[model samples]
Target: MMPDRSDLSAIAALLREVAGSIVMPRFGHIGPADLRTKSGPLDPVTVADEAAERALTEGLRALFPDVAVIGEESVAADPALLGAVAGPAPVFVIDPIDGTQNYAAGLPLFGLMIALVEGNQTIAGLIHDPLRDDTMLATRGAGAFLLRGAAARAEFLPLRVAAPAPLAQMIASVSWQYMAADEKSRVLARLDAIGQTPNLRCAAATYRAMASGHMHATVSRRTLPWDHAAGTLIVEEAGGHVRRPDGEAWRPADIDGGLIAAADRDTWHRLRDALYG
Candidate 1:
């Protein structure tokens, strides 16, 4: 089931509130003891990530008592929690700080991402940027929109993907670090030859950039639900396309394989063949 309009607004507000009370206050004030190495030294997790996730999880549970919540920190503590996404219960997936590395270094590129998953499909999605005080939201069958500011006078901008552009004129953002080391060079060499590729190190911001019509496409091998669920719905609602490089629909339950999204199918196919073939 999709999140109601009022629920989306409330969740968006909840994200901002959590960030204000739990995330922003501890941004540049973290100490060595508050940080830890996760997957590797380059992958870091902070107290803020945990705090934000905890607060959001609890807040969401209170709002929708029957829904299950799967957060990044929660998954780290128990990988089994991912099973909830495919279960009968509606699951809310959360990524508290998508660009933890950027956030750790005092950059404001990080944001919070949440998606409502019913079985295998994403029914509703939201990506919130506390730094900018705006949110990109989409519910199934409903158009995506950008809500600017949190005040009563907030502005709503209807979102649409940019007009289709040729491969040579495309501006794509790719996350190369997620690719296999041996194949990264060849793939990137070809990507650089065709378009201007930039890595913002944050999926939420990258998706926002695409849905906002500032980018043509994005390629990524990391396909975690919390990371891509909200993004897929937002871009699709904006009239863009998303699928695996081999041409399969993206579902919240699948966690492997690469994804390529573009403003049009023509661009998606061209970019997919050029980069993956």
Candidate 2:
């Protein structure tokens, strides 16, 4: 059964309102607020991120009791919880804050990304940019759209990628970490060899650029399902393709592998080959 657009719109609006209230109050507060380093010093999580995730989880669970939820902050506390939910049940995966670094730095480049995942497929998804008051949403066949206002009036916009361009002429979005030093050097060398400029904007904005035709492609060695699931559907719906560099299909279950996404089939294939070469 298809999810209702009105319900999704309502959820988006609710998320925007809640997140805006939480984030807006801390815009320029400089003092440290009980930061914790998860994987490393570079991977920091703040009280605001956790508070926001809690708000979303509670609201979703209250609003839709049947659906399961897997949030990044919750999984961070209990990594084993994800395996327990690995079944056919529809799970709502969420990254309460995609660009944690940006958020910590008080930059407005972060967002709240959520997706409804059943098995290996994403059914419905929304990425809400509270700073810009823009919500990018998509359901399986309902098409993608941008909702920007209090009334939540739908502005239908077909997502389309530009024609396949050469890797040299493309602006690639690649992350700096997640790969070994040698592997990172090799990837950077190849990117430089192709004359492609590498930009490491947070995943939300980076994928948003890919969907909006502002960037050609994005490759990541770190596969956080919560981060990729929502954006993956958005990019594919926008006429792009995402897969492992070896040409294998990607799923939310495999969150420890690599991904290669492009504006089109030609670009996807070419980038995959270049990355593996």
Off by over 4 Å in 1: none
Residue 3 lDDT (model 2):
69
Top candidate on lDDT is 1
Distance from true location, Cα of 246 in model 1, Å: 0.9
- In candidate 1, what are the lDDT values of residues 1-277, reduced to their tens digit? 6677778888988998998898889888877888998778867899999989999999999999988899988898899998888776789999999899888888889899999999788999999987887899999899999977765766668999999888788999878777787668868778765568888989999999999999999988878899999998999999999998879998887787878889888889888888877
Per-prediction count of colliding residue pairs?
A: 0, 0
